[model samples]
Target: MKLLMFIKELTMLIKSLRGLCLCLESGSGDKLSNCTKQHIQKLLKANMMGPYGSEWAVEEKVKRREMVAPQARYIFVYWNANEMMDNAFTPLLGFLHFRFTLEEEIPVLYLYELQLDSSVQGKGLGKFLMQLVELIAQENRMGAVVLTVQKSNSLAMKFYISKLRYVVSSISPSRVDPLVGVEKNYEILCKTFDHEAKAILEVYSVQYRTARRVGFMAAFSDLKFED
Candidate 1:
């Protein structure tokens, strides 16, 4: 079956560009309009290595491919038409992969990955793409938008937490059992759209904070990190 394509255009100030002009294209795995899976894979491999070192990157790449390849319908590809390289049709600035699912029985949009080229990292593209995702969720009547972030990636954590107003999910693995989950490297984060979803999600965040406090006290009661 041929997948439907949705193209959205917006104006933004890019460091390398003269004026506001960006395009977001959405398509399924079978019908990528102007790019290929290889292109997306290359972008992912290039941008997803800061937090996760090269040791398990190959394995992780495979896992990511498996997740996104099957559900490309939710992939949002960001293109910069003016920065094309030799023989390339469009400059692949970044992409967002997500899907709709039930989180705590609440229908939500789960963002799998949002990656941008190093050249385009700090130019507001990230926030623009994220806002677009929330718009997508709201249009579909989803209760919330969710994503996971690596704890070690302080830049990303700050972006999501401070700029995007996302909070660590109450039911995130680490929050659920901090003592045992203390070794986890990632945290699930979310942004809810409605009063009902906000109330439901806030309960989890409060519970998690309480649990984390207890865990922190217990963890430091016997041991300490030496400087």
Candidate 2:
């Protein structure tokens, strides 16, 4: 429970920092768009907007979507060290998943990657993190959580459906959801945020970790804008 408490604090911190940073950068500066825009602009500032676009361009789009993702409003979750866990705690990419928030009033979690430090696999830590997602979403009043899985990955599919009670709903275009994985799916599941979602995601740590590593993130929501 100590770890859970730390997670809650961290989530609050992430929300605050992201909101603050956006406030500072929102609606200001010259209009640059798309990841490719910034790239081409360095070569020639004018045509780049119509053509290759810039790094800020792509980032802007991804940022906007975080709030207006057609079918869902998303919030990312991450974790960091806590009272119980020591600084030596193992982490993968400082967090997990690069999915989206379903664009809905109630919201749904669409998890992408499940990258864990190889040291923790098969130990149910993934399940724990997932449950953590559910808990955070519920805490934030989300409806359900959804994720896509590879059709070939029976092992993973089984883990989710059997262990987590997720059911296969639909397969994608024989290709993976760009954010999810190699398999095709639109499988959905529901967890009782009030019941099982007792934990919170450490979004603060998640955001900091992301910012520290990538220096650019449009993950939680899309950051695109029009000129």
Best by TM-score: 1
Tens digits of per-residue lDDT for model 2 on 1-227? 75687587646544543222211111111232353233322322231223323454874455344323343322222233232255563322113332335432335556643444343456555565566566655555665565655444567668888998765432233211345634422343334333222121211133443564464455434576679
Alpha carbon lDDT of residue 164, candidate 2? 87
Q: How far is candidate 2 from the true structure (C-alpha RMSD, Å)?
A: 17.7
lDDT (CA) for every model shown?
0.71, 0.42
Minimum summed lDDT over a 10-residue window in model 1 is located at: 1-10
**How far out, in Å, is residue 1 in model 2?**
15
Query: Candidate 1 residues 1-227, lDDT tens each?
Result: 11121223222222334343566677665555444566677776776665777545675756455544655454444545564455544356677878888887789998888888776678777887787788778778899998888788899999999998999887677767787568887898999998877766645665655776798899889796789
Which residue runs does candidate 1 get wrong by more than 4 Å? 1-20, 30-35, 58-64, 74-90, 205-227
Which window of ten consecutive residues has the lowest lDDT sum in model 2? 20-29
User: What does each candidate score in C-alpha RMSD?
Assistant: 11.0, 17.7
